[model samples]
Target chain A: MQFVLKSVLISLVLVGAAFADGIKPEALSKDGAVTRDRHLTEIRDIMRGGRGGYIDFGFYYTPSREQLPLESQYGEHDGFAFNHHFAGFGAGEVARGRHMGALLWFDRSGWDGEDFFLFPHYNDFSLQRSVVTWGLTFTDARMDWTIAAGMQHQNLEHRGKIYPYEVDSLAYSWAHLRFSKLSAQANFYRTDWRLFRFSLDLESRAIYGGKKSGPLTYLPNVSLAMYNADEESDIDSMRITWEQNLYDQRLYAEVAIDLNDTWFHSAALKFYPDPSRMIGFEATCLNRVRMKQLSDDLVEEESDLLWGGAIDLLFARFAYNAAYDYENFFGAKGTFLVEFKFNLATIDGWLFNRGAARSAPMETDVVKQFDKNTKQSEITPMGSGSGAPKTIEAKGIRYEKAQPTATTEGGN
Target chain B: MKGTMKKISVLTVLLACCLTLSGCLTHWFVDSTTRLQIENRSSKTVVEIDILSEEDSDYKVWIRDTIRTGEKSRVYEEDWVGTFTMRVRTVGSDFDIENLKLDGGSEYMVLSDSTDGSLHYEFK
Candidate 1:
C-alpha cells in the first residue's frame, strides 16, 4: 500500500514535469494603465482554461447505501451508511496533438475500501476506465468554439477472493462488465451575444458503441443555453437550457434509458455583486423525464429545485471553490475544491496577442501614473458612463474612452 | 414561499428578454490585437507600405500591403507585440519611419501629407 501511494505521487510529479514547458514571453514596454489591463486579461484567460490534462484525485463519501438488494442474501454487510470511494485520474496531450488537442486518461476507484490494509496484498483495487479524446479549438475575440471526438472503455468487477465462491472461475467473473462508447461533440461558448453582458451557447453530440456485434447504434443530442455575463450582481443573470436525446434510437437503448427516450429542461438564476471580486448565489430548477418505462424500478427520474451559493477566491495561479448543494433525493452535501493551474500557451505569448499583454505587475502601473502626472497632456476616457476612468494605454500614449454598449453586428 | 415565487417570476422575465433580444442590432468589443489605420491624404498616390517587426519574423507579410491615393486602409491587426518599422513608397520617393511600436488594445493611425515633410501620428 505504501508503495502504491508513493508510486502514484511520483507519477503525477513526473508527468507534470514532462509536459510543462518553460518559456515566458518577454514583456513589452507599455505605459501603466494598459499593462495593468493586460495583466487582468491574462488572469481571466488562465482562469477560463481552468484545469485539463492534469492528474485528478478525489474522495467521495455518502453515508446512505452501497449494495444492491440482491446482495443482502450474501449476509456480509453491516450498516446502511457505508458508501465511500477514492479515485485517481491522470491525462494529458500527446506529441502530435497539433492545434487539435489529443488526450488519453486512466482512472481507477476503490469502493468502501480502506487505503491501507494489514498487508499490501489485501488492499482492494477494482474499478478501472480509459478515455481518449481529440479536440480542436477555434478562437475569435467574440466567439470561441471547440470540436472533439472521444472513446471510453470501462471495466467493473469484484475479485471474489474473500468469499472463495469462484477460485476456479474465469478472471473478472464475480461482477465483470465491460462498457465502451464512441462520441463526437461540438461546443460553442458565450462568444456570440454582445448585449447586456451575455452568454449564449449551442452544442450537439453524436455517440455510438456498446453491444458486441449487431447493427450499429447511435444516440444523438442537442442543447442550447443563454445567460448574462457572470460579472453582474443582483438579479443580473438568468440562464435557460434545454437538451434532448432519443435514447430509444440506440442499439442498446434498453441498457441506457429505462423510461423510453430522455429529455431535460433547466432554468437558473445567478446573482453576484461584481462577482469578479467576491461571492455569488444561484437557484436552479431541473426536470429529467424518461419514456417507455416497463416498471418503476427500471427508471429513476426527478423534477427538482435546487439552490446553492459558492464562495470563490483567486490568488496568482491557485484558486478555491466551496459550495453546498441540496435536493430532495440527493439531500444536502458540501463540496470544497482547490486547484492550481499552469497554462503553456500563456508562457509562450499566445495570450498576449489578445490585446492584453502582461510584462509588468501592478508596480509598473504606479510608475506610469507618475509619468502621467508629469506629462502636460490630460487623458480622459470618452463616453465613460461607469466612471471606470477607463482608457487603454498604447505604446507611450494614454487615451481614455467610454465603453460602448454590447450589440450584435449584423441583420438577422 | 411568496418571495421565492416572485424572484422566479422576475428571473423568467429577464430570461425572456435575453432570448428575444437576439436577432437585433450587433455590437463587438475590441481586443489586444495591433491595429493600424492609415489615410493617404498625400497628393502623390501612396503605392505601397511595409511593416517589419525587428525582433522576429513571426509576422512576415504583415509588412506588405498596398494603399491607393485617397483611400483609407486598416493594416496589420495581429497578436504580436513589438517595436516595428514602416516604410512608405510613392511614385517619386519613399519615406522610412523607424520605432513605430505597436501592441494589443492600442489604436494608432498615420496620415501622409505631402504638404509637410513631417509625419502625423494619432493614438487612442
Candidate 2:
C-alpha cells in the first residue's frame, strides 16, 4: 500500500512540473557555495582550511505538461520562489585540526494534481522540511576528523479546498503525513584523498560505514548499510564508488554502484571554470534495474535510465533531463534554479611547529672575550715610574703598532 | 540478473587488485642526503650550534668553535633522518628552530640579531 501511494504521488508530481534534476538525495551540509559532495568539502576543510559562513536562497521553476497518469485529467503548474533557504558557518585551522560549524536549512515545494474518476477531484499537496545541524572537528596523530548530527522535520499536507468525490474512500481532506528523524555522521580524513565515513539514522536504526584509501590517481570507496537492526535480514544495501579529481580540482568524475534488491548505478562528471566554483557544468547518467515478485513463484524485472546535464552560473542554474521509466511515469523535464550566496568570512590557515624545546647553545661571545683579555694582560706587564714606556690595553681584536725609540737610532 | 551479477563480480575483483597494488607501493623510491649550512649574519659571534633529533633525543654538536660575524659554517650533512630541533647561542641571545623536517636537499639557516637585542633565525 505504501509503495503504491509513493508511485502515484511521483506520477502526480510528474504531470504538473518537470522533476528537479541533479539534486542528490543526501542532505546538504553547507550554504551551497562549496562542492555538493560533503565528503570532498570536509577533506578540503582539513587540507585548505575552511569557509567561515554563508547564506543562500534558491528558486525553482518548471513548465506544466498535459499528460496525466490517469490519461483523462489535467494539472496546473506554478513556479516557487525562495523554495530553499540555507545558512551555515565553519572555521578552523588545518594544522591544529580544530574546527566547528553549524547549519540551518528550510525547504518548501508543492505540486497540484487533478483527476476525474467519478467526478472532477482536485488534490493539492505540499511538502515542507526544516533541518538543523551542528558539527565539531579535532585532530589525531595521523588523521583529522569531525562528527556532525542533525534533526530533520517534514510535513506533507493537503492544502486549500478539496472537492468531494461523492465516495467515502476517495476523500482527500484527511491525507497528511508527518515525519521526524535524527541522524548522525562522522568522517575521518587521513590525507587529501584517504578517508573513512560513518552515518546513522536514529529513527530507523539504519547504519552505514565507508572507507577509502589508496593512491591519489585511483581511489575506491565502498559503503555498506543495514536498514533495520531488529529485523532478520542480510545487508540491505552496498555502495561502491570511484571518484577522481584532476586539473587542480577543476575537473571531477565519479562512478557509483548502489546494490539493494535492485541494481543501480550512476556516473557523473563536473567541470568548474573558476576556483570559487560559482560557475560550473555537470552531466550525469543513472540506470536502475529492479526485480519484483509477481507471485509466490513468479518474478518480474524492469529497467529505467536517466540522463541529465546542468549549467550553473554565478546566480542562476538551468538543468534538463530525459528519463525512461519502466512504468512510464516520467519522460522528460527541465528545471530552472536561481541561487544567491553571501560569504561571511574565510578561515585563515596557520602553521604549527611546536615541540619540546632543548637548552640553549654553549660558548657565548662574552666568555671568549674575557679569556682573550686575560691572556693579553698576562703576556705583557707594564713597568712603573716616570719616563717609563706606557702600555695601552686594546679593547678591539686589532692591536696597535709598536713605537721605535729615537735614542736607540742615534746611538746606532 | 545475470548481467548485473557479472558486473558486481568484476568490480569486486578490481577493488581487490587496487588495494593490493597500494600495499605494494608503500615504500619511497628515492634515497636523499640533506646538507645544512649555518650562516652567522648577526653582529655577535655564534659560539656553539647543536642539532637534536626528535626520534632519538640525541644532540649532535655541529659547531663548537666561534663562528665569527659574516662567516659561514662548513656544510654539515645530516647523518640521521627525522624531525630535528636546532639551537644556536650567540653573544647577546639564543635562537631555536623546532620540529623542522629536512628532506633530501640543501638547507640554509641564517642567524641574525634584531635591533631590540633579540635573535632571529630563518630556514630556507
Candidate 1's C-alpha runs over 4 A off are: A1-110, A115-267, A271-281, A284-412, B1-124
Off by over 4 Å in 2: A1-51, A63-83, A91-97, A110-143, A155-234, A261-264, A289-299, A322-346, A349-412, B1-124
Docking class of 2: incorrect
Q: What is the interface RMSD of each candidate, in Å?
A: 29.0, 31.7
Please, what are the lDDT tens digits per residue for candidate 1 over residues A36-113?
222222222322221132222222222111110001111111111111111121223332222223332232222222
- Native-contact fraction for each model? 0.00, 0.00
lDDT of 2 by residue, B3-121 (tens): 99999999999656433322222213321345778788888889887765333445557667678999998886543223457667676766666655554346787878777776677
> Compared with the true structure, what per-residue lDDT tens digits does model 2 show for residues A56-155?
4443332221221111011122211113334444454455444455544444322222211111112221112222223333322123233333333333
Worst 10-residue stretch by lDDT in candidate 2 chain A?
A169-178
What DockQ score does model 2 reach against the true complex?
Answer: 0.00
Q: Which ten residues in a row have the lowest lDDT in candidate 1 chain A?
A: A170-179
